[model samples]
Target: MRAEEQVEAVVVDDIAERLRDGSREALEEAYARWASLVHTLAVRSLGNHHDAEDVTQQVFVSAWNSRHTLRPDKGTVPGWLVGITRHKVADVHAKRARLARDAQAVAENTLPDESAPPPDDLLATRLVLHDELERLGEPRGTIVRMAFLEDRTHDEIAERLAMPLGTVKSHVRRGLLHLRTRLEEVDRDPS
Candidate 1:
């Protein structure tokens, strides 16, 4: 074997021996020796250093916690750590996939259908209509808002405003024409 690999194998063998004898320092030495390899594997699989760090921590915690269950006769320390790292990496991938699916579901639920007018266009139209109504002012604006927006009838408007029925009808017709003209002008010259 190469120099570093031979040294690593020796270190792994030593750590395994310490662990089997219930040495308290074995776990720390195990983490020091293998943490980079575990973290590197996690980062490659997860594509993010933050997630890789979390997985690396989880792998060591799981290894330390389950140290008593390990069979040193059946496996080396590095082999056991590699298994733990695999499981941690899988868990991270599952979490990332779940988060991605949840975000997609939320977007689908909140967004309008593709066929509908875009939100910005709808908002701009409402604002422009409101501005034009304000510019109309006085009886025409008030009458139009009541008749269309409030769903009021001509008789209701005339009696509410204390005016002649013919005057309310005239205002409704002229206001509609004026709004149509204003809207058409805006549509033609959007700038």
Candidate 2:
């Protein structure tokens, strides 16, 4: 294996040994060393720092809670931690996406009328959409809003954002792909 993988293997071995020996300090150290890495991976995949941190904490807490079932010979502890982090990240992403879709549906059903104030549900959905857009970050969120939310053409978004047409198109495509993946995740969940 590569040097980094070798180091990871060593760390996993040490952590497994500590757990087997019932050393609390070693378990804490293992969590400390891997938490940042796990969080970073989660944030990259989920596009939300809060969700990433949650997944990271869940991974470590579960590892500790299930320590009795761990078998080092089957796999490295770090590998197992990564697997848990991935599942937890997916779960959180699915939940957030479902909330977003539900909010969107409620928003669509309660349009504002000139004679009356906007419905509370519509206002809530707008807030959730705004928060989700902000969480998406950068040109991707802006591009998605302009192209999809605002009904602007890709060329229009390019002109508005002061970017090349191809760049705007790329951002729209990527943003849509990400959104689709999140939606599919929500659909797949039994909960």
Cα displacement (Å) at residue 32, model 1: 1.1
Extract clashing residue pairs from model 1. Answer: none
lDDT of 2: 0.73
Candidate 2 lDDT, 1-191, residue by residue in tens: 99998997887788898886778987888787778878888999988887787788888888788787677889877677788888888777665665466446533543445476668656554555565555566667777776766678988878755579998888888777776666556557645
Query: Best-fitting candidate, measured by lDDT?
Result: 1
- Cα lDDT tens digits for candidate 1, 77-179: 8788889999988876765565455435533543445687667766566666677766766567677777776678999988866669999999899888988
Give the lDDT of residue 17 in candidate 2.
80
- C-alpha displacement of 130 in model 1, angstroms? 25
TM-score of each: 0.54, 0.52
